[model samples]
Target: MEITDRTFPAALVALSGIEFPWDYNEKTEEPAPSNIDYEPYDEFDSAEETTDWIRSWTGNKELDGDAFRMFGQDGTGGIATLWLVRPGQPLVEQPVAFFGSEGEIGIVARSLGEFLWLLAGGVGPQEAVEFGSDSGVPHDELLAVARKYSGIEPRTPAEVLAAAREEFPSFNRTVESWCR
Candidate 1:
């Protein structure tokens, strides 16, 4: 489905257009530390693309990617998506999650509200793999973006990530279990 205003939150739709900063080695053209490690897509990935990706990643053709609304990716092609687990709720209510190209699975934030703060704190969904080990730097633009859209009060990246992990402790295990 298209990410129209009716289908996606205003904040998220706006966020899709942001071009995150990246630092790369000149010689190798590879990612370096202190980079945001995220790139927001201009729009959500097509359903066919999502399906093909999931099938390739899981090695299970039966598993569809319908539950995922992919909007961004990392330098290594790790996906950032809204996991539509809450059946009746809107996209903003769903969890923001990461599926790494290296098989890393993590829940970045419980909702879009927290996700904005997470981005403001400079922790992209892909960077979420490090969890408590990394201290996220603040991004001024993202902070403004978060403040513009999120009515919820601000919280540290640690707080948001911890809450998401606590709420879905079995997430990693569940996703890993699906691997063939």
Candidate 2:
């Protein structure tokens, strides 16, 4: 299935059952801090908006935003995006990566399918790099969803990161080149 297909959204909804430091919204601006819990937005950013953000992030006006489709953000406002490196391939086959608010970047999963397992294993993009796979409590609901959708065996967060980086060794350099 395509990344923009209904299945992708459904998977996100299913994974939403787990408590995170954020809420999913269709649209949001940079959030302000409050005494209450910090709630970040996990909703998918529109393609045009994502493109604009990418261009701004890299300070490169000539770059096309088609290479990325940002889907979520952590409480600290780090972005989670699907990287479309495999030209001519479906979005589902693309890799999922994170660009943190503080210049942290890493490929979190080799594909959308692997990403489901990552969620099931209780690791987000930031957590996977910052805290590793053992940080969060695993969720059964996410596990079931991962099994149902991906049919791949569960893996540790470290394994996921390694696999993605191996498959796309040039990802970091590519992003670096886009930087001003």
Candidate 3:
């Protein structure tokens, strides 16, 4: 799916004004270490770059990046992406996933809609998969944005994380298989 999809762009626009602790400083290529927050990319990674990174990450030149669309990253350079596991489906239908810089991986949300709720609940990709740390601090602005775009009822962080993992139980194993 194209990165210019309606829902994703709308969500990004909604989140444009909010400041997070993990926002990357392009000048320095670093993030503040104080708070658990998301650092959205100014744009999605190009197809070529995504493919190259995936090949490098898995050490499998035979693999292509068509299965993923990386959109953002965490403070530590952990990436957040739309995992297009559902064939012939729109981008919104795909699951949102995270691949941490520290070798952590997980499906964070069932879809972009669920992802908004995850963000509303103050859980970023890294937080959801890594230590499963619950910030317990809700972002009302993000919640509002999520509701505006998704119109889905708010869910707890734990619920979103669990559902995603349950839905894609083999994500880790599948990804690991690609590693040489």
Candidate 4:
């Protein structure tokens, strides 16, 4: 997560272009229905809540200045740039990767389990709080989870994992093994 100033803008621009319809459910290895949606998010609350949840998970990092910087193609478009700054260090624009095609810049999920819960239909802040109780979010960490990624639009499992890998490369094999 070491982002150079030169790469920051490029990362933001690339993130804003993230689209979907990832060949996840539809196994092109086999033949299946086109079950993925690669469209811009239409739900504002869901998107915002999700963003809040991610921010909280990051120990309440600021998005505009000291921590992360968000840029969108337009005021109403999806995200473009998400700059994460380490204390006393240069900013790192996280890998906001995608599945199939790129759509727009999007927020990252706090954890794998949280992403799974969200995929399972946890949409609102209160619902996320309840889901946290049942989904191993831990009582102490509940507030953090609720605060981050709660209303922001979620990336797909594949996308989330990809970004997580970029952020925590060593955890990939462990996380995969655990998921299986």
Model 4, 30-78: lDDT tens digits are 2112221223232212335535633543334342122233332222223
User: Clashing pairs in model 2?
Assistant: none
Q: List the candidate 4 regions with Cα displacement exceeding 4 Å.
A: 1-7, 13-66, 73-85, 93-180
CA RMSD for every model? 3.4, 6.9, 4.9, 16.2
Which candidate, 1 or 4, has the higher TM-score?
1
Cα misplacement distance, residue 125 of candidate 3 (Å): 0.4
Candidate maximizing TM-score: 1
Candidate 3, residue 44: the lDDT equals 66
lDDT of 3 by residue, 14-35 (tens): 6656777545447854333334
Compute each candidate's TM-score over C-alphas: 0.87, 0.77, 0.84, 0.24
TM-score of 2: 0.77
* Local distance difference test values of all predictions, in order: 0.81, 0.68, 0.76, 0.31
In model 1, pairs of residues that clash are none
Give Cα distance to truth, residue 125, candidate 1, Å: 1.1
Off by over 4 Å in 3: 1-8, 22-34
